[model samples]
Target: MTGTEPLEGAAPAVGAPLLEATGITKRYGRYTALDAVDLRIEAGRTVSVVGESGSGKSTLARVIIGLERPDSGSVRFRGEPVRGRRARRAFRHSVGMVFQDPYESIDPRLTIGEVVAEPLRAHGLYRRDGAARVRELLDSVGMEGVDPDAYPHRFSGGQRQRVCIARAVATDPELVICDEPTSALDVSVQAQILNLLLDLQRRRGLSYLFITHDLEVVRRISDEVDVLLRGTVVERGTAEQVTSRPQHEYTRRLLGAVPAISPRQRRIGAPLISDAPAVPDSKESTESKESKESNSA
Candidate 1:
């Protein structure tokens, strides 16, 4: 996902990526949160970034979506630099985000109609028909016929997440950075949300930079996967290649750590460098990426 090279025989990405981050490094004091990280998301594809907690996954997510800027790197959306007020405003409208917790992300004071229509209002999109568009988005996320005047607290967790999805896609964003949007839900509800996201992606052609620690979820949803150890990417490939045939010790250990529910759990053997010297933990730092928030819902 780092390189800009096109696949053999495949046409070029045309002009530039829908979204690209290159040589991204974010440092807080002596700690390097992101170490020369690079990621590219093409149109209509899901490139999942999978790592354990504190692996800088959220930092990367924030940087990509314009909530935070890297200390030494560049982020481009549709070939436009995501800097300055004007460019950032354009970036926010082009990209949407779904946070990990639906309840906390939505404002308690806002009704479902307001929550979904907020993005439209921010971007001045669908202005005259905002209410109709909100209903369409709600219906699209499987919350049709519900009272748009209802508050966030009245909805169940899954229902709230549906509303979140409706808001995220309200402005017809080309890319969506989903930061563990399903991790907080029950297993059944998680499945439902995942399916809804996939359906929306299919209908809207929305690219996704899905951030998660769950390898199982990655395999189910991602076309390509990046395995992050600490902060840097240790392995990258198709979901089948990276998950089933991991080439890094850290990735192998992660695969091994997954819970086995059956007697016949498949084993992913260690890498050839299993006996090699242990790699040092990435010199990473942590800070809230929520500062300098964009106009996303």
Candidate 2:
């Protein structure tokens, strides 16, 4: 069940775990979205779930974040079981999420500042400081230049992502789940957002469950990776081991698909290899040139 924002507020306990999920499993009809998944985050370590489309990466994230309830698993916060009324109250303040689609995830009705402060208002994260806290949140995400009053539609995709990040980090959340946070932006912009997230992590010591289809992205931010295939984890290791010495067949297949981009494919897609002159196929080019000369002769 998708959770509605919880009602009633409580003071967050002092110096406790950011978030935790253990033995998480979810099913839909005959299919399983997540099959007995075990995931953990230290105080400030990032764990990335790497997989392609429909591989249950997103489902695991949704379940862990309390967007969906697992069939039989427990989510914990600060070494306490997160399955009761008090746990739900703590979760509202302790966890924040940056969704894949920034455009749809942000409300168009609210100004960027309003959007950023929504969680703050929802959980009383900034009930006292108010606008000052909002500005600080914007600056924390490298969006201090943008006026809080501006509409989200006015911002570029990368900038929209910045707003999303600002909103996620507003409450100084101990844990943030980034769901393909850069997949919708230009390559250059993707780099900027990645850097921003890294900077924030360094400054705040925030832990993350980073999810993405991009191996290059996983390499940059992930300390460890869980390779999910058909709702099951096929491989789990450090990013270096997974990228350099893949063990699973699915992992190897994904590694093989990473194209060594040509100068052309760097601009277009991976088909630029076909457009290049090939050594064996050069015979056909030579024949065509001779044919042209004969016609001229």
Candidate 3:
């Protein structure tokens, strides 16, 4: 790949794909994590990658963010090759990441302000009056007036996630990679976080590379969906189209597994009663009803 300079500005030209990866491949010893994966993200749009565990979703994210170099193929940002120090620095400035686990992604020792300001410090973008910027960032994510001296452990799971998001956007990056960002939170808190992301995108015109396993979450947030299986993209299309009318067998099976509500069930607000036989309940039994229910979803 040729070394080329990225655009100085964070935003891409209107209607252009901000990031593109073509024929990307990666392998670990005998196992391939990705196989000739091609993906694109348009400016100011959300493109989601969905797959089961070990399906190479995380590998793709790592490659895009420059954490892992692909064994083959190329990555481009704003129509330029992401090669050499300057180009990579430009890429880092243009892209931000919100990792899967808020608890582990952040350092417990650092105060909230220091954690959020780390990106600015790395890029030499920190200002002498940077405390104002920190406050503004926190307010943007709905955490106004939070004490800058407070450590991460003082915050709840959802609050820690908010701080993480605050840090990711500190540089006002054009693209954000969200890797299963809400998977660790409770269902109610997940909704709030999703809405916060949506608001941020709307206000900043940010493009998102959202990686998750939940199709329902994909349906809610993505403009397009790419379904990966065994390190290859099995199917891709508009979110509604892919989820509603999958063409590949793998895609079909994945969609089929989603718990759906039938028309009758919707009308009754519950599933139809079945006459199936119940399992014999005993304290000494190996199987428990709670265990079965826990594994249902």
TM-score for each candidate, following the candidate numbering: 0.82, 0.81, 0.83
Q: Which scores higher on TM-score, 2 or 3?
A: 3
lDDT of 3 by residue, 29-112 (tens): 878888888888999899999888888999999999999999998999999999998999989998999998888999988999
Q: Rate the local accuracy (lDDT) of all candidates.
A: 0.75, 0.73, 0.79
Q: With candidate 1 superimposed using the best TM-score fit, by how many Å does residue 292's alpha carbon deviate from the native? A: 36
lDDT-sorted candidate list, best first:
3, 1, 2
- Per-residue CA lDDT of candidate 1, range 210-274, in tens? 99988877877888887776668777887888788777777777887865423332354322222
Error of 2 at 259 (Å): 5.3
Q: Whole-model lDDT for model 1 versus the true structure?
A: 0.75
Per-residue lDDT of model 2, residues 173-205, tens digit only: 889999998777654456567877877888888
